[model samples]
Target chain A: MKKRAVAYLFILPAALVLGIFMFYPLAYSFMISFTQWDLSATRTYVGLSNYRALIVSPDFWNSVLYTVYYVLGVLPVSLVIGLGLALLLRDSSMRGVGFFRTIYFMPVVTSPIAAAMGFSWIFHTQLGYANHLIDSFGGEPVNWLTNYNGIFQLLFDRFGVELPRVLQGPSVALTVIILLGIWQNIGYATVVYLAGLQGIPQTYYEAARIDGANWGKSFRRITLPLLSPTTLFLLVMFTILSFQVFGPVQVMTPQGGPLQTTSVIVFRLYQQAFAFYRFGYASAMAFLAFSMILIITLMQLKYIERRVHYD
Target chain B: MTKRHVTLAIKYAVLAAGAIIMLFPFYWALSTSFKELRDIYFEPYGMFPTNPTFSNYISVFSKAPFGRYLLNSLVVAAGTTFLQLVTACLSAYAFARMRFRGREIIFFLFLATMMIPQQILMIPQYLVVMRLGMGDTYQGLILPYAATAVSIFFLRQFFRTIPKDFEDAAIIDGCGPLRILRYVFIPLSKPALATISIFVFMWSWNNYFWPLLIVDSTEMRTIQLGLALFRTEGGIQWGEFMAGTVISTLPILILYFIAQKQFVKGITLTGMKG
Candidate 1:
């Protein structure tokens, strides 16, 4: 009885803090989602109207679409490149391996706002290094951030191809933000993949070599299968992270970029809640985004975990 | 050269190219920060600053309350980290060792909080803090993050791995539960404590959204919010902006360089478990 009482005493502080902050606020947020509050003295309960409006709102859908584009753009490219880097640097005994790892991981440690600032300077249209490089090569200076045209449309323009609006890819501005995401994420994925690579048994590789398997054959037969768990982990993590990307979008393209092409879900939520003082509407949007993330995570676990090879 | 040597050379070459690409942004930011406005705008810009000056760095401090921003960030981050450590240590000790009612269920509840996205909680949390009259206060900034599921979960796993013999010996010496935690578990789990400390400190330092929502005055702005707001207000002053970025990043970068192994291990530990 004394021990159990002590245990309760031990948990008291944490329980108080978590209960007051996380658990209570979560319930309060849910309750607020059902109301119309504008930071005023009173909140009038409206009963799902906020959610219904979000479901039919074009701006809400646009943010979701752009978020999906950002996720798709960042995830696969970073995974493949990260994996490749991991493979290249797998031999820890090799000279400069640590040096290379440190360089790659620097951006991961870098705050997103700082990274965005660096990228903004790099891609600045007139007075930027990117344009300087283009001018040096006798090419036209690309409007990297200001251009509202989707990258697909921009690419197809040279071929006299008019891509439909829906078929058009992420706007050039949003693509810049996506590029930043990929740049920061590649290092994290690389490090995680490196750890995964370390767990593979050397005997497995020796056996493959003895069986007359080449590098490509060994990679496909051994490496890919062995790294599936790591891949899934990275996939879930990157998806959750990419969906909530706001700092860079806000820093790089302040007003959600040209035509609001870069206004991701969190950015929209922030604007609704703070800028427009539509707390109820923003809470509804938050729940919707949260549900979407939950569903995707569950779906990934259910379907993707089946294929994950665990030793 | 032989095929083996050629392949080695190619490998090094590729790694070198990748390193250059990775380091270029930092290099550019550093390089631009030192340049005069004339040098920045001059046609046929030099790769490195021809006439490097400290004017931008000086102006960054002069033009805004950047020093105060750094202080605010330090206070909030340190305070939050200290509080998180205390709360996490206590709860994790209980979850790891003590026999209590509903222990498993409570542990699961703590784990469930990890999945609740901050976006969902931010609105009401803002309201709660404001209602409590902590708006724009350090406590408002620090207390909400005083307990995190990540730290508690992490410390619990570490504490579970500790040998039972230590606790038994401590108890034999007439140490109570609190004393055992302080004298035995904490002292023994120095590495684990350090890992969590660095992780929490870095997280608090880099946090932008919470501070943005809570901070209303120039005096309370963190380095992140200060830098961001500076970008908008000090439009097109790229030199000053880069200077601000370098200053804000320097502390974390210095910490990373000093504790590179801990940073990597912390990431792997949290990344794998969480």
Candidate 2:
């Protein structure tokens, strides 16, 4: 009993935190989600109406697609780059590998909102340095955010040789945000890969070299296969983080402006709850995003665990 | 070339290019923030200015309550880190060494809550704050973060690695839990505490959404949110925007510099291999 009391003391602070901070809010959000509550409305229970509206709303659906794009656009690109760096920098023989590793990891620690603000300037269509390069090549300055329609059509057609005139993909504004997302997050994946790489005993690679296993074969035969667990964890975490991406959209591309092309699900959720004062609908939208993330993380974990070599 | 040398070259080449792409924004922000309006506006590709100016940094301060925002960020970040360490240490020490009923289940529950990505809680958390009338208050912003699952879990893991003999000695000396915590456990776990401190500081400082929901007062806005407000000041103040970016990112970068060696070692040692 005395030992149990001591153990209970250890767990006390965390339990108290969850009670007041987590569960209370969870119950609070659930209660708020089923009502006619807005900034001025009464808190009367309205059954499934907010969920119904969310299903029918085009804005909600736009966010759904935008949410999908968040996964496709940022996740794979960052992972490939991160894994590639991991392979390069993990080698002890590589000069300046530590310097390069620090540089890549720097952005992950930088504020995402600040990074987005800086990117907004970079992708600024008129009088931005990015467009200035294009102008030097005898091309007109393009409004990256304003050209959202053209981006989708252009991307689907295997990228545009000539910029098209249809709204699609992530808008120029959205692209800048995506770029910031990619930059801030790639460091995390890279570090994970580096850690995994470090875990692989030097003997394996040395043994491969002794048997005349070439670099390409050694990497394919040894490194890639061994690094599966770290890669899996990265994928799962990335999926979760990507879905909850809200701050950049809120701060960097507030209002999802330039025709609402950047209306990601979390942004949409915020707008619904706070801006539109549709608390119920916002809660439902939040749940929808939560469910999508949960399903995706589980799927990735299961799929990757099959190939993960624990030893 | 031997296969080893060839692969090494490819590896370094890819890493160099990748690192450049990752860091270009910082350079761009610095260069643009110093250029005159005409230079950034007309020349656009002005990577460097003939005469760099401090006007952007000046304008950033003049434009808003930037200094207060910085203070607010520091207070919140410092408070969160301090509180998280305290909570994490106490709880983690118990989890690491205590014999108690229902301990595993409760710790698992805390871990489970972490898996529930925070967006799901945003609205509800906001409502609770609203009901409690903590909107726009620094305490409102700092209080919830006093306990974080990740920090606790990491701390507990580290505490487990410390030799149990230390605890046995403390107990022999008639030292209670808190005394052992202060003198023995704390000194022994300085590494774990430092690692968690940097992490908690970084996350608390960069955290935007909760601060956005609760801290509507410009006086209490964090540097991250203050930078956002600076951007909304109705002008394309590229100079100041970059200046503000620099201001917001500097603390996190500094924290990284000081504790990074310990931070990296902690990550590797903790089996956070992910």
Candidate 3:
């Protein structure tokens, strides 16, 4: 009875918070999505128009393609670098391990908006540091941000080849946003991976080594499998985060400009909601985006949960 | 022993390189903040300033009502953290040691809410906030913001792990739930509370979007919105922006440094899994 009392008391605030902020907003957003209500002007019910626009709109599809491309550009490399750092730091015998971990996690604590500004300045072609470095190497300062037509063209260029401009998925301005996203979040995923590394027992490593397993072999066969759960968690998180990305696009690609190639879905949603005050239209868009995220993340949740191995 | 040394050497070298790259951007942000405008741009990679000036910092405050913004943010952050911890503690204790009907279902339902993005709810939440007539008020800022599902849930989870006998003993001595919590659970849960409070404080301080929607007047602007005003202000003064970032980021950075041990421990313990 006493324990029951304590338990009820304990869950009360979190329950209240979840009820008011999260649960209410969720149900209310769904309701808002169904109605043509922007709240700034008079709201009216126009069921399914919002959902219909999702399938028909070219911009919506393009945003979807661009978001997927951005995820590819950032999330995979983020996992690799993060996992690499976690592996690198796991040897507790190493000196200054704590300090290294601290420095690595610092970026996670810093504001993304501020970091976006820094990256924007760094990537500026004319007077930017990147251009300065290129000049020092006797190379021409190529327009990194302006020249990319879309994703396909961008891929060809990376392979030191050229493609027709039509094949590209995202613009140069948007690519910078993607790269900066990876850089900022790699630290975060790395910290999470480091904690996950704690679950692995040292005896396994020693036994593997005694059996004449090389470092690469141990990492591939043992570490990789063990770290799958963490990787899955990170993948789901990154996918959701990718879909809702706004800040970098806001700062770096102000109108998601350079031919609207950088304009992501969330940025578009913000423009419609706040800037245009087309709350009803924006609400429709918001809900559509929300639904897409929900479906995708739900799929991910199912996929990852099955593979998750608890040690 | 020799193999161990080799592995350790490799670990240090790789970790050191990654750490340097990770920290370089922040170092540059701080260095540029102190730099004279000409040096920052003309020699972009220059790690040190030829001439440092406090003028940028002065301009950040003088050109805008930054002091007011900082105070506004501090009040909101402090108030939210205070209330969140109190409510979270009460609720956490209820879930931890208390026998309750529908405990598992209610708790799981609450946890399920965490998986959804807050963006989905923006319009409706805004409408609710507007309807409440709490716009531009501290009560508006503090009350709505205090619904910290993460903290309360985390606290509740922590409370469950603790042995129930301490509370039982205290109760047998005629202590009430609140008193038992005051003398017993509070002491043991200090680390968890500190961790939760710091994050809640940081979240409240750095939150821009929701506040931007609700906070109508310039005076009510938190530091984040105040800093973002640079986005629309006089020149897109990159120098001033760096300066402003440096100034605003310092207090939190300093606090984080002081509390880093607890912060890291908290994250490692609560953030890794359930």
Top candidate when judged by TM-score against the true structure = 1
In Å, residue B219's CA in model 2 sits off its true spot by 0.9
- In candidate 1 the C-alpha lDDT for residue A7 amounts to 94
Native contacts retained per candidate? Answer: 0.71, 0.77, 0.52
Q: After superposition, how far is residue A88 of candidate 2 from its true place, in Å?
A: 1.2
Residues forming the 10-long window of minimal summed lDDT in candidate 3 chain A: A163-172
Model 3, residue B46: displacement in angstroms? 2.7
Q: Looking at model 1, how many pairs of residues clash? A: 0
- Segments of candidate 2 deviating more than 4 angstroms: A1-3, A39-41, A150-152, A155-168, B1-13, B263-274
Model 3, position B202, has a per-residue lDDT of 69
* lDDT tens per residue, model 2, B67-166: 9999998999899889888888889988888877677887898887777657778887877777888888877898888897888898888888889898
After superposing candidate 1, which stretches have Cα over 4 Å from the reference? B272-274
Give the lDDT of residue A278 in candidate 3.
68
Off by over 4 Å in 3: A1-17, A142-148, A155-169, A304-308, B1-13, B265-274
Docking class of 1: medium
**Which CAPRI tier for candidate 3?**
medium
Supply the DockQ value of model 3.
Answer: 0.51
Could you give candidate 1's per-residue lDDT for residues B46-106 as a string of tens digits? Answer: 7788888999999999999899999999999999989999999999999999988899999
